[model samples]
Target: MAIEVNGKTIETDEEGYLINLAEWNEDIAKILAAEDELSITDNHWEVIKFLRDYYDEYQIAPAVRVLTKAIGKKLGPEKGNSKYLYELFPYGPAKQACRYAGLPKPTGCV
Candidate 1:
């Protein structure tokens, strides 16, 4: 599938994850929010930005446990807990959130 944003096209896999991670930015985030049926809020954006930065720095997409732990360290305990993370991305924080963040699937997810 392809996601069109302001006349530019981004390719996605059958599951809606961006095929090319290089073609991502805040604009792509907006398109992903729409594709995922989410209303982009400050909190949601925070998580998305964090995911992108984490990928850039670590070169790996974190699993749910790692994500929660790391996010808790950076954001706060309340924001980084599994319950909170799951509330934000019910399909699995590492999976769904990474997809929206235009990142590759986290290793060991399946």
Candidate 2:
């Protein structure tokens, strides 16, 4: 599948993750979040940016458990827990946030 962002046709997987990580941008992220019925706020951007940075360093998308722990370390405990993360990305923090960050589906996510 594909999504149009800023007049460019960007490709995505059937599940909506970007086909080319290089094609990701803020506009595309907004579109992806809209598809999931989410409105990106500063709090949401924090998670998305964090996910992107994590993928950059690790070369992998983290699962929910790993994501929570890492987030707690980097962002703090209050923002790192499942409840807080879920409040930001209700579909599933690692999966949904990674999608918005234009990373692949987190390993082990169904």
Candidate 3:
């Protein structure tokens, strides 16, 4: 499938994750978040940016447990737990946030 962001048509997979990670930008994230009914906030950007950095370092998407711990270590404990993450991405933090961050569907995510 495809989504229009900033007048550009971006491609996505069946589940809505971006097909071309290079095509990703903040505007793409905004479009994806809007489609998911989420209003992007600074808090959301924190996790998304973190995910992008983590991916650049590891070339892989971390699962929920790893994501939470990594986030705790990097972003502060207050923003690390499942509750806070869930509040931002009700669908599943690792899955949804990675999608918004323009990463692939995390391994082991159903």
Candidate 4:
């Protein structure tokens, strides 16, 4: 599938994750979020940015448990738990957030 962004067509997978990670930018992210019916807020950006950084360093999308632990360590405990993350990405934090961040589906996610 493909999405039109600023007059350019960007590809995505059947599940809606970006086909080319390098094609991602803030505008693309906003479109992806809107597709998911989510309005990007500062808090959403925080998690999205964090996921991008993690993917950059690790070359992989983290699973939910690992995401929670890593987020706790870096972003603090209050924002690290499943409850908080779920509030931010109710579909599944790692999966949905990575999608917004233009990464592949996280391993172990159904």
Candidate 5:
């Protein structure tokens, strides 16, 4: 599938995740959150941005433990802890956030 943002086309997998992870951005994230029927908020944006940067640097989705740790280090304990992350993405932060970020399901998520 393909998602269009500002007249530019971006490709996605059968499941709707972006095929070229590099194509992701805040606008893409917004489009994806809309697809999932979610209203983007600061909290949601926080995770999405973090996940994108994490992917860019690590080349892999951070598992829950790594996610929490990285988030804690960067955003402080309030936003970084499991309770907060779970509240934002009950399906698991890496999985659910990746879905909204237009990225594929992380390896080892299941």
Candidate 6:
């Protein structure tokens, strides 16, 4: 599949994750967020950027549990909980946020 951003076509997998991680940019993120009818907020960007950094270090997208723990460690307890994450990415924090961040889907997500 493909999405048009800034008059450029970006390819995606069947599940909608970006085909090329190197091609990721803020505009692509906005397009992904729009697919879910969400508007990126500062809170959402925090999680997205956090996930990207986490992936950069680990070379893997985290599942929800790991994501929560890692986020707690990095971003503090207030923003680490599932409640805060779910409020931001109602469709499943790890999956949705990773998608927006242009990381592959988390393991064991099904």
lDDT of 6 by residue, 1-110 (tens): 99999999999999999989999999999999998899999999999999999899999999999999989998899999999999999999999999999999999999
Off by over 4 Å in 3: none
Model 1 alpha-carbon drift over 4 Å, by segment: none
7-98: candidate 3 lDDT, tens digit per residue = 88999999999998999999999989998888999999999999999999999999999999999998899988999999999999999999
Instruction: Tell me the TM-score of model 6.
Output: 0.97
Q: What are the RMSDs of all candidates, in order? A: 1.2, 0.7, 0.7, 0.7, 2.0, 0.7
User: Stretches of candidate 6 above 4 Å error?
Assistant: none
Model 5 Cα lDDT, one tens digit per residue, 35-99: 77777889888888888888878888788888899999999999889999988877688887987
TM per candidate: 0.91, 0.97, 0.97, 0.97, 0.81, 0.97
Which candidate, 1 or 5, has the higher lDDT? 1
| Shift of residue 13 alpha carbon in model 1, Å | 1.6
For model 6, give the 10-residue run with minimal summed lDDT: 66-75
* Local distance difference test values of all predictions, in order: 0.87, 0.93, 0.94, 0.94, 0.83, 0.95
Candidate 1 vs candidate 6, lDDT winner? 6
C-alpha lDDT (0 to 100) for residue 59 of candidate 5: 80
TM-score of candidate 1 against the unseen true structure? 0.91
Tell me how many clashing residue pairs each candidate has: 0, 0, 0, 0, 0, 0
Top of the candidates by lDDT: 6
Clashing pairs in 6: none
Question: Which lDDT tens digits does candidate 1 get at residues 1-110?
Answer: 99888799889998888899999877887778776787677888899889999999999999888999999999999998989888888788889889889998899887
TM-score of 2: 0.97
